[model samples]
Target: MQKQDFYQSLVKQAQALISGERNVIANMANLSALLFTSLEDINWAGFYLVDSPDELVLGPFQGNPACIRIPVGKGVCGTAAHAKETQLVEDVHAFDGHIACDAASNSEIVIPVFKNGEVFAVLDIDSPSLARFDEADRDGLQALVRCFELTLS
Candidate 1:
């Protein structure tokens, strides 16, 4: 499928999966699994929830075991949460302050998930291929994040 079409379908599927669910953890778990299973070339897909002003605690995930904690502004996931903007890194190795949760992840995309107009968590996806994420991925994933935001609202 074309990238846009694929993302739209994924978003639709995610919406269906969590449509009536109001629990945040349940939504996160399902969304992570949805992304991990639907996306190609990804090694990790999960959440890093805001634990404090400067730290994130790992949440539901699908992949090799990952870092349990990440400080805000420390890595792509943290950076996105801190900045409240998406972090799409084509080369994770070159990003300053990168936290290598998995050595196999060469690229990463982190999207801030907001609640009450503040960052509540982040959706993190890691790929083993350089430049694995593009603008389409960013836009698509941002839409997916919106689905979560709406559900968690």
Candidate 2:
């Protein structure tokens, strides 16, 4: 299957998994597991929730242990949260201020999850291959984020 179609299916699955569940942690846990098992070559897939005005705390994920806290505007996840935008890095090593939670991660994508126009958390995925993510992955992940965001209220 094409990447686009795969992502579409993944997004649908994510929506269905979280449907009717109002608990944020439950939803995040399910989504994290969904992304980890569905996407190939990915080393980490999970969330970093906004914990304070200047930091994000690890939420739910599937992978090795991750940094517990990331300051906003510091790393890839922080940059996405601080800018309220998605950060898709073809090469994690090339990104300035990239945090090395896992040295095996060569590429990454971080999408900010918003709630009522505010940054609620970020959906973060890491890959072991360079240039692992492209525009298709970005579009698919963003769509998934939008689907998840709908449950925030």
Candidate 3:
């Protein structure tokens, strides 16, 4: 399927999943799996939730073993949390101070999840292809993150 169609289907599935249950972790896990399976060339898709101490604790994810903790200013995920905005890196290696959780990951996108105007978590996706994501992906994934945040509450 085309990427746009795949993303739309994912949004529909997420909405259905959230409507049927109010379990945040379960929902995130499902979403992670969906993104992992649907997106091509993706090495990772997951969430990092903000802990009370202002650190990111690894949440639901689908892929190899991942970093369990991340400070707010480090890595793409952490940078998104610290900036409270989306960080789309087309080339992970070129990003200064990039964290290499998986050397195969060439690109990444991180979207901050907000609750009551504060960042509470981030949705992170990494790809094995350089420039794997673009503006369309940014818009679609940002919309998907909104669904995720709403389902959590």
Top model number, lDDT: 2
Q: Kindly provide the TM-score of model 2 when superposed on the true structure, using C-alpha atoms.
A: 0.99
Which residue pairs does candidate 2 place in steric collision?
none
Tens-digit lDDT string for candidate 2 (1-153): 999999999999998999999999999999999999999999999999999989999999999999999999999999999999999999999999999999999999999999999999999999999999999999999999999999997
The Cα local distance difference test for each model comes to 0.95, 0.97, 0.89
What digit string (tens of lDDT, one per residue) describes model 3 on residues 1-153?
Answer: 766786788788778877767777898898899889878889999999998546899999999999998988888988899999999999999998788988889999999998888998899999999999998899889888898778656
**Count of backbone collisions in candidate 1:** 0
- How close is every model to the real structure, measured as TM-score? 0.98, 0.99, 0.94
Cα-based RMSD of candidate 2 = 0.5
Candidate 1 lDDT, tens digit per residue, 35-121?
999999999999999999989999999999999999998988988988889999999999999999899999999999999999999
RMSD of each: 0.6, 0.5, 1.4
Candidate number with the higher TM-score (1 or 3) = 1
